[model samples]
Target chain A: MTVHRPQPPEDPDLPERPGPAGTPPRIPEPLSEPLSEPLSRADEAPWRRVHPVSPLIRGWIGLLAVAWFWGQNWFEDIILAVEDPGGRGAPPMEGIPFLGGVAWLLLVGGAVLVLVGLSFFLSWRFTKYQVTDQHVNVNSGVVFRRQRQARIDRVQAIDIVQPLLARIFGLAELKFEVADAGQTAMSLAFLRLGEAKRLRNLILARAAGLRSAPEGTGAPGPGLPGTGFSGTGAAAPGSGVGPSEPAAGAVPATDPAASPDSAASLDPAEAPERVVAAVPVGRLAGSLVCRPLTVATVVLVIGALVLQPVLTEDVSPLVVLPFLLGAAGALWKGFSSGFNFQAAASPDGLRMGYGLLDTRHQTVPPGRVQAVQIRRPLLWRPFGWYRVAVNVAGYGPGGDGGEERSTVLPVGTFADVLGVLSVVLPDPGTARPLELITAGIDGSGDAEGFRTTPRRARGLAPLAWRRQGFALTDTALFARTGVLGRALVIVPHERTQGIALEQGPLARRFGVCDVRLATTAGPVSPRVVQADVEVARVLFLEQADRAARARHRHDRDHWLEENPHG
Target chain B: MPQEPVDPQGIAWTRVSPKYAAVRMAGWAVGTAVTLLVLSVPLVLRLAGIWTWPPLWLAWAVPLAVLALDLVRLSLIPRQVRAIGYAERSEDLLVRRGLLFQRVLVVPYGRMQYVDVAAGPVARALGLCEVRLHTAAADATIEIPGLPAAEGARLRENLTARGQARLAGL
Candidate 1:
């Protein structure tokens, strides 16, 4: 067995490819036989163009603009001609010699069509993509040529998006999200759905540093030296697989033959995936009904109806039109994006599929999740529904078009939430994980060892004084806050970017402070608000040491060999 | 006066140069002069008999109020500068700032993405530079302003070295 250190590219012109001669065995073989056929042969014939109809599909927007302008002008010209039958008013194109109005229209329309077609052709000619074992590169742009290349290992998530237009043509788009926030590093748009899936699998497998194909017959061997029995194992008590003695019952062995779905005809090159949670349409609709925005919208509409008779006739319906449209639009966006949400656990990481018209399949790799927040809206408490979001390093800041791609579970039962949590973190760093999580969610006031906000905090947070607190385990910190809309944010000690203790003048008078744990730029922001100043200071100092120690313990970059499931 | 949160940490915090207060006062003076110059236009117009829409007292009142407020703020420069201090620990760097809303941030060296040494024209003339430590988190940008140029360079180098030594992936 040999260990391969990730070697930096030696030259600017030529990056060091992983699968060349004399390289380590683990990284090379999987590249050759990716998917059904030899993808290496396809890779050798590099710079493959996207689907031929890609330009036409993308050019529809431009086509629509042109058609709109032409239609508007054409209608005005015909109407003007009708109003003045004897050509008393000269047409706009009258300066041109000998051409009738219909002839001029045809000529100009043909010219516009030619220009649009030429530009589309040039765009199609210039745009090209290449996938090497080391990098995924895309070269595009007609005027200002741009070349984007993201390292295969740096890919944080891969999304397969099939918009209604593209889906009609049996095509999909591959979006590569790197560790940089809010930017798709590279996109190969309009590929055959099957090809896109295969390409995504190839990239994920290579990223995981797998020796065998992703869906090979054998289970992943104990490849890394210090994986299952590392000294840090004791710290991850929730994982249940103890370091000194592995618990067989807690972890289902990765035996494909033993699994019931082994008989299903799965793609040979894809990993055996198990669906962890699926939100039904009925539940999804119910969850949406309770949202604060939806409720407010409903109230506004009802109030408008109730006051209709008493209100003055001078009040126009258009006055309230904009607000109604805005609110309803927001609700529709939430509903569509979360239409058929499904979360699956695979060797690569957590795979989620959602969206109504434009279906999206996003795969967030293991170990990339910085923090997780399980939130229960006030109305959702009765149904026992919780929404889970995370702080992934790359997917932030309008990455989901103001619709949070960070949400791993949009709406799920408590059991479903735990299942997703178990897969994402694997180890909650506590012996009694269920009780601790339950306390963090439903219980308050020092339950399950949580340090609740002191009585002095009543002045600062009157309603949430009892619940605004924090709890710590060996591997992670749990900060719970809010009374009406409860939130429990869990930040793994290793992932904590910084710890801060903040105190305002009012809080200073009350001898209270807030402790904040900064993670990546996403939805989950861990903060213990309105705590005793003395306790906050101690926790702040202690948290720094804990984070440093946690970082020291968990250093493995190649997560595939760890066998998180087993 | 409120207690400083850094008291319990027992870490020796390095204070910025005293000249920073002078720099800040000078900046405030320039800003106030420009503001007063722009604001006195209405007063000049009212007094010159060219325009009397705004009452003469009202025009005069605005600039006087701005000057008075600026004077009070300018006096607190030294104390605000004193409140801003940074401490370098074995595993992390701690930055504390703000007089009324005191905040102390402890950023682990391993979490640092990069170190930036920036000097504005005013600070550059005064031979001072600011050091900024950027992490993956957007909110974790730790800025330690008003250091001597040489000290700032040294801190940047030290932080960059430490970050590389204990570098962890996002």
Candidate 2:
């Protein structure tokens, strides 16, 4: 219960503790004072408070929600009164006792804000997080008093999220991807952007099992046993200080200037990274314009605006306002999220920076990617544009941030797609990866060893039968489906969660079955649709064996051991 | 005649206890009755001179059709129970279920997060329990029902041990 004030890591008053190199030095809480009980080994790490303005950021979001729900009706009443002065005769506020309606609304709104602000302030006062070598603990909740801890070894990926408001305040939220699927084990909200970055680095460094020392040099050092045998710590990718000297092993094409704003970028202190994909604004806009939904929305709006006055006298263009609003929201979301999309490969797996108003920087660690899918929409085929999405464990269903979290490349050319894919799946388990990928994306009907749907499946798929195919490589399974909007999903054998063979009544008659390779919840679904019944059966058995064998080859638990570079 | 589908690997499969058919039928009977009562609300309202929407005949026909549907479902319950089977391999467990829409799922031990043994009141009354294998992928979950309670516990233990032994962290 003793209050411990925060101090700089280099404080001379605190005793020095030797720790992993490249980890931000920590000033352990003084052991001299234990107010009520004996200090446990885990409690040695001081429970640091978040930034003071944490509550303001959190409460603002809550306040916006409240206003959205209540203010809309209030505004409508005022607008109705103003528009038709003779209808109600009196002011909209006349019916209220003592206080006018506006005055009452303002009073209620102010009270609500005060209550929300006070509660948030109290919660922020109680909320504190601790980081030890083995665990990251977050204790919060004034009434419920919940304590959540994520084991350092169980860390999957670390994400630094900056919403529009948070960005304005120069603060970020640190979200931890732990062993649990679809749930962020722990999140430390409203830390200074720089502090969040440093904390994430320290945690990743510890998770990689790197050795540390007080004021240790930020260099790629030897890791503990059963990990970092390569001395590069290439297993976890971009964990630890990340080769501060630029040793030049795997990360080629180092272009730190790819992003315009270097000062505002994430991991400013980290080693140089290989710029794999930097989407141009023109390409992103063009790609979006080519989408069927965009076309439909544009046509709908134009038709409503132009034809409404010409056709019916009573029908107004405003009749389609709801549809237009919905379409605008979707389009704006897509446009803003994909703005300035940049993906780079560093010692830390893949680092992606995106969003116009709310920028997010996420690091997907090595071996964490379960599946990768390259998609080409029908309209985008002419431009040869492709979008790449991945399935990573712990990212959760639909991704908390939206599809942008899973989408490595929002929209890019084939070369850009391949560049991003190379960074994601370093060892694609196929020697002829380019040809295989090319075939998977564009080729149809028994091209490059892919087995297409049998002629009998023509009745079932009709348009897509010829394009539908599957190819099993040494380390991955590729399923290609769709005719107009082609998609190729690649699921690494080792990452496959489970395999299933589905035979519906109609498919049974067609002598075909769908082979679904189960992966973590994300955009990429590794489903081999409408394969010949015999082929699917064989695939089911073979894939099971392949997955088992692949699992044996991988050190799944120790992600910091399997050196992709090596 | 169409050839009956068989497991491609020809592995011996374990069938659920036959008593599950009765348990399922009982559960379904209660569910169907509730659904029929709910479906007959419109007819009852029409008869009581409270509300009128579709003609009187249509209102009565809806519940009758639901009754007919439930009868068909009741007839298929035993066959569906017979169709459910599971097999444990060296490194993975295979579960196959369904009659017309058949599916065979193979879940590797290394990928399994946990194992669950659950039994509803009806199932418990029949002294039967179901074993569920959960993986990181929600869709990959496999549930094997109609095992004796003791056997379900044993299966859960066995699966848990295998999963831990092959603990491949997601």
Candidate 3:
């Protein structure tokens, strides 16, 4: 592949240059030429080596595993029939007297071996990946060829995974998650380490270039200047290239009077430059290593180890050794896999790269982000940081035939969380500026600037244990009460669907009621917030009115557009 | 300060038929009876096996007790019906119902996506129907039970038309 060196313009303000003055400007090279020519078929287009895992074979193996465990009783019954041919201490076998004993063992053993062998062979053959200038492509499958391609622009995030065995073999798997088109998000997996990193950088550069470019192109321009838009050849040093300048419908003007700093920041090369300096390896590892799933897995393993001997009478205690060993190996693998997690602010959005055996890389673009959530668990309080996740449309499965969506950052520190949030949210700084509204135990008086609703105030001192309520920095949304646990939710005015006012027999006697403001994100089920029935009625009406007004201003269609990077 | 009771009109009532109260009461009765009958089956068989006279009477008495409980519950249907009501205006739809406690839910017609009107055999015989107002909220669904059939249909039509108009304006 040919590499292009960008030419620097002659400017007195620029620092001394190391390269020769008269050399021709080099155009950055594309990763690989598209297979536009008919002659370049699969064979000629650089034979991609892949490890195959056929879908049919994978299904069969999964079936075999299930049958082995679930049909253990059937297997045991067959053994009993052979041991006691005359049906002594055995349930009567009603059919198929001939070849019953030998057939059973052959069927079970044959099925198990076939499934395991096929799986291993397929895993070895079909998994091959190629990273190109525009997209990352993965080809896998033995019987049914499955090929998945994710454009650099649409790739939201990349994850690297290195299984213990794969790490031993010096191999890593790269997972490229693209924004979902419908219920499925495109993914590319399994690439060599060096190739994966190089490809990751190429995709990151393209994503960043797309972000910095005028929004209409959607396609990422080459890293070199003058390649972004047609007829706008390389501008001289210091040409004003404000985004609005392109909107004025003026022909490209070559002027050498714009600020260099602004122009430099827009450059595609500058995309990697900014990210390279701030890649938070430690923060990324901290985010991925201590996820809830990891904790749950560890707890399950410990429980299984403790119960193994007690649960099985016939099996000797030695059988538990393999189970313990496997659990320990898996735990160690999980830890090592996330140890190298790294997240960087790339031009397109944010790029999270990590893995132990198979490296997974992800790139998220800003346009694909639907919403941002910042959560602070009690255990994470001492860290003075919050975990951040983005709600993106068509990104994950919604459990009952609904669209699939997923969070961008499953975990991250406050600064890292804020950094990613700024790119995805319209106003990144809004969370920091807002004061948190907390629900009190009673309807009594509150801290300065906070007040309890009238319903809660009625039994203030006496029934304080049951009532809790508060509004935020602004009274736009309120968390009134939670009987079991406190929950704070932001009910956007536009997103509010309705209001519910509930009064129990006891509450009615006390002239107190609870009101809930519902939103599209989820139902706001606040309990025990006290207010008079009349006040509750009025609050419901007011909230509904605000919701209607807000809904009017929302543009649902904007979220439907396909994001090039997730 | 003590607050005066808010007018019932101010509270939102579900757009449902009075027959829903009857159906709910019937369902509760059936559920209770079935539960008691299931619990008595083994006892009856065991009683028949040993000490037949007094045990058989006790076994027979269990189902009778369940039937009596169901009858008492059925008697509360009218009061339950009185507690349920539906109110619809140009801007919003309200559904209110409760036994011992009252709940008033308000769903703005503009935010409503659709309204579903349905009736089971018993409700149809009683000339009543149930209406459910669907919104974008993931979990919040406003259901009004036991409305006269004609009123339920009219409310559904109005809600649908208003929702369409609001959505079009957007």
Candidate 4:
């Protein structure tokens, strides 16, 4: 069989159709096709615009400022010590000739100046980005210059993030996710709100054009481009169906000349339409308070306060309370900030916007999603809510290895939960609500079409001591068990990597074994399913075999039919 | 010319190198000793005037406990090694390992991402290297430690080339 190859575009200008009203018009295609041609040379030109150094660099700047302040204090102290030795503790050592005070100021001043200067220089050196007709290019480095470019077609998701300060200034940062390779992502830092939106529209248009392009095109494939911004728009032209489909709708049809103004208005409204669900404030508050990290932080702060007087002897017990209170306030503030979380479905995939103070927007496309996980904490049972997250490739800061993408839904009610899940998994809303299964497990027998396995039933007693596993009727995802301290793991069959049947010497003698399902995120141990060794072995093997087969088939289709660009 | 069967032990049996078991024992011994030595240093320093109390003494207890745990663990390592063995056939690589828990990880040549040959300082001193078979899954990495450096490098090259050939077929 001949390998499919995209035909190269002969004229670069052919792809550069001016968008409505001087805005770059989207290429006329679904936003899922791969680009056939290399990005126009104009797209890669340097000197378009550059980003300030990442906020991480500001930390260095702050450090340098502190050092300068400290140096100044030290200099004054030295002057006093030298000039008045017996006056305080020891007179300033200024009598040590010209080398004492003068030398100190010069040394300290020079060091501080150098540090401040380097911060600015490094920021300038490390932040550079370019927007062109076909792609967004970013080149960053202090010591080793690395270049990353995202073709409009390959752009799977776009995100716009505005820090509180940035929001006040109407400035935002943009991120473009290309594909599976983490290194290929392009980021645009600190653009004016208008400029960022314009850039987003242009990139989205390009992505749509590339998506609609015929297969074997050299362009990047269609998916949600990873945009780090809080908002993303996944707009693609209807695939090959012609304009007739969209034109048949409720909105009035406009001539091509009138389309620009209409499109602009339509574009802004698209953001709201894409939203699947908004996270409830109450549920988010509960989840945050329930987090082990939050609990540990509180415990540590309280312990520090209580022990400070005994340990230090000099520090007052009252001093500890303020510090503890301050820490608690900060935690509460951070949690509250992300309370009104919003998840929206974009043309490319999904965009989740959260956080109150340092608002974060993460964009994930359907294709980049490796797996989905739904977790319900034991305490959350009464509320009928679950936490959902996806395992996507690429490791970012505050991520768990290469597994972290973004939490699509930190905490949401059942309908809101299903709304987000449908974007990631197949047929999510059709599944039964969680309450029925819980009631069934409680022996109310209200659950329909759900039966607990003998192993699961026996396992329930031990599991209830920690947490009981329940099933969502009509969904393949299983809730095996929950513990008070552990996150309630919901493992969908498709995402399970392998199953391990573990038996210790004690357990082996008792004829009970634990079955652990492994995923890319981490190992999820579902406690002793109360089965004989032989049965356990068979179950483990069966699950593992199914997982392996499913993964194989999925990968084959993905590599072959799905990602035509790669 | 006729091709010979690859197994040295013939049908119904497989012979794994005794060196594999020896190397595992050595690793456990060195690991335990180093852990004990590291843990004891803090206690010694605390007895001196160099530092103050709450010197993470509880954290230090973890490694001390680990050292004691390794004694039991060392005894279990052999059975684990015996249960685990690697066999290379024309089509795939089969890795069977586990003790009370057993697993056989099979990787078709086509699915391999890369083969990494690495050695820690201690393993290098023992003239051994580790070969890690990697796939796309971030966490699904399998390592065969304590191979001779030459064999490790050779295996890496062979697997890499074969993996490339298979990828090209796709």
User: Which prediction has the highest DockQ against the true structure?
Assistant: 1
RMSD value for candidate 2: 9.5
Q: Looking at candidate 1, what is the lDDT of residue A414?
A: 77
User: What's the TM-score of each model vs. the native?
Assistant: 0.85, 0.81, 0.54, 0.62
lDDT of 1 at A299: 82
Q: Write the residue-wise lDDT of candidate 1 on A1-566 in tens digits.
A: 01122322223422112121122312111112122322343235245556656666666676667777887887766666666655445557554433367578878887777676677657765777766666777878899988877887777888888887777766788888887877778888877676677567767766776533434423422222212222221121112111111121111222234333321111225555556667777788999898887888778878888888888999754566788899878778888888777776666778788777777888887788989999999999999999999887768756554344888889988767876787677678777788888899888888788998889658778888888899998788999998889999999888899998888988888888888899877777789888787788888888998888788777545567444323
Q: Give one digit per residue, the lDDT tens place, for model 3 in B1-170.
A: 11224333344434344447778876786798678879677577766685444566677777788778777867877776776666666577666666666666677777676678988877788888778887755445788777788887887787778888786211
The TM-score that candidate 2 achieves is 0.81
Lowest lDDT 10-mer window, candidate 1 chain B?
Answer: B1-10
For chain B alone, what TM-score does every candidate structure achieve against the true structure? 0.91, 0.92, 0.72, 0.63
Which scores greater on DockQ, model 3 or model 4? 3
C-alpha lDDT values of all predictions: 0.74, 0.74, 0.47, 0.49
Looking at model 3, what is the TM-score of chain A? 0.43
DockQ per model, Cα? 0.68, 0.66, 0.34, 0.14
Name the candidate that leads on TM-score.
1
In candidate 3 chain A, what residue range of length 10 has the lowest lDDT sum? Answer: A236-245
Write the residue-wise lDDT of candidate 2 on A362-476 in tens digits. 8887678889999999899889899999987768666477578889999987767766777677666666777888889888889778998899889998998888989977778
